[model samples]
Target: MGRHETISRRQLVQVQDRFIAAWGQMGAAWGVSRTMAEVYALLYITAQPLNTDDVMDRLRISRGNASMSLRALAEWGLVSRAHKRGDRKEYFIAEQDVWALSRKVMRERLRREVLPLLATLHELRDATDNRTEQPAGAPLRLASDDEPAPADARKPVTAAEVRQLNDRIDSLLELVQTVDRLGERFVGSDGKGLRLAANMLSKII
Candidate 1:
């Protein structure tokens, strides 16, 4: 290669390395697997699909790690399989559209994290609803003189306290439901809703 072409290639390689590392860090923050994010970043920047060997070579990851990351990325809809004519090896490609990619990520987060949190909160709310019907022998019983309760005897939970806790849970549930609804609207269909919503918000802002 000519000097100019060689320099350009070297610069591109540097940028790719930087991006892969940065993306992996971001993925860790987002609770995604770092190797998976790096693998996706590599494929995202490359012009052609890469098989398992190519991915391992580029990222310096073991065969098992590369395979697992590729499988996970595929599960998240961030990567897809491709075949070259006359090639038996399975190659992978990343989702190139930024909007679609973001929507997919958000959808997974809503499904995996937000929904489960909401369910747990609902269970807590139910548990707190019937404070009065607490079993006969409550843990926080105040000791009488004859019974000689412990010096550190604590006051039992009251109906008012339960009501307050229930109300707080309700408030949190409302907020989380709003988020879930908004996430649903943003991620529905094939990426159009997200783009339109973002564009409209940008214009308003």
Candidate 2:
């Protein structure tokens, strides 16, 4: 067992304040609300689970705002609920391990954002392919074997444009799929692969 050093009240407050502010900024970049990120940051640094009133008071947020933020964090699996032995009020705690928290966030983002966008891209590609498969207007075969065809052949021109558009869409779809696979690998293997990569990079630098 290791001995624990006592942290002064002022030092603890300062640390918590810094974490909350920095996390609020990071939260926006991560596509989550600043308040939600602050709440998680506060919970993460606290040694004990915090009740709703405690969170609202410390964060200087309205009860509704704290409640909603906590709920969202819980939904994302970044925060969890706790119950004190004799207390009827609910308490919440944040997941403290940075790597695990990040993995959860990435997993949720892949499910909510990346996967849906990929599906939409697939639909667009399918629609474009269907349009390209059919003749643009009608067959443009010459009536006479020796007759010179019209300079403006609408059929070929339109078909070529449609095929070109479909090809572009196919390329975009492939890029998105590749990104999706990379995300899966990053957060997969229970985050072991990610940790290993981070360790290797640290040594290389």
Candidate 3:
């Protein structure tokens, strides 16, 4: 059967129910509220393209809630506006391709959440290091001949700590760079290429 004929009324209802529940679970994991997840699920499961009114009617949700949810979905790239033939009003449809949707959502999260945190961490590290001209630890400081330091005295480690911190930052930056590269490849590659990369990424991730 063709795509249109494959999805039946009973199947749509069942899929909608399952999608709604799954959305609740996934949303919680992603820091979204339960109701928002339900809204997303409603959009994801519908076989027919729907308008805001359709969404509100199917989900039995308020117009304001439907509007808010659709806005959020648009921002995430999971749903987009559909202009129907001879229709003045706009309809909406979920991205039918799951892989593309996944990529968009992941990229958004990495950009909005991970990259900012990484920037903040770098800023803090810089601020902490800028206060001192030389290494803080006695180990980093040149020993004075007249003031003979005791053999038992351990060297101070302020400089060493900073170096270690910088090293960690470098490692994290490398990982981020790799992620960006992989994201680019995924976006540009064909199905066979994406499948191979996905298999590799699963092992690494």
**What TM-score do all the candidates reach, one by one?**
0.81, 0.78, 0.66
lDDT for each candidate structure: 0.88, 0.86, 0.73
- Model 1 lDDT per residue over 55-86, tens place: 99989989999999999999999999999999
What tens digits encode model 2's per-residue C-alpha lDDT throughout 95-139?
988888888888899999999999887776665565456677644
lDDT of 2 at 11: 91
Steric clashes per prediction = 0, 0, 3
Q: How high a TM-score does candidate 1 get?
A: 0.81
- The residue pairs found clashing in candidate 2 are none
Cα RMSD of predicted structure 1: 6.5
The root-mean-square deviation over C-alpha atoms between each candidate and the true structure, in angstroms, is: 6.5, 8.6, 8.8
Clashing pairs in 1: none
Model 2 TM-score on a 0 to 1 scale: 0.78
Query: Candidate 2 lDDT (Cα, whole model)?
Result: 0.86
User: Which 10 successive residues of model 1 have the least lDDT summed?
Assistant: 136-145
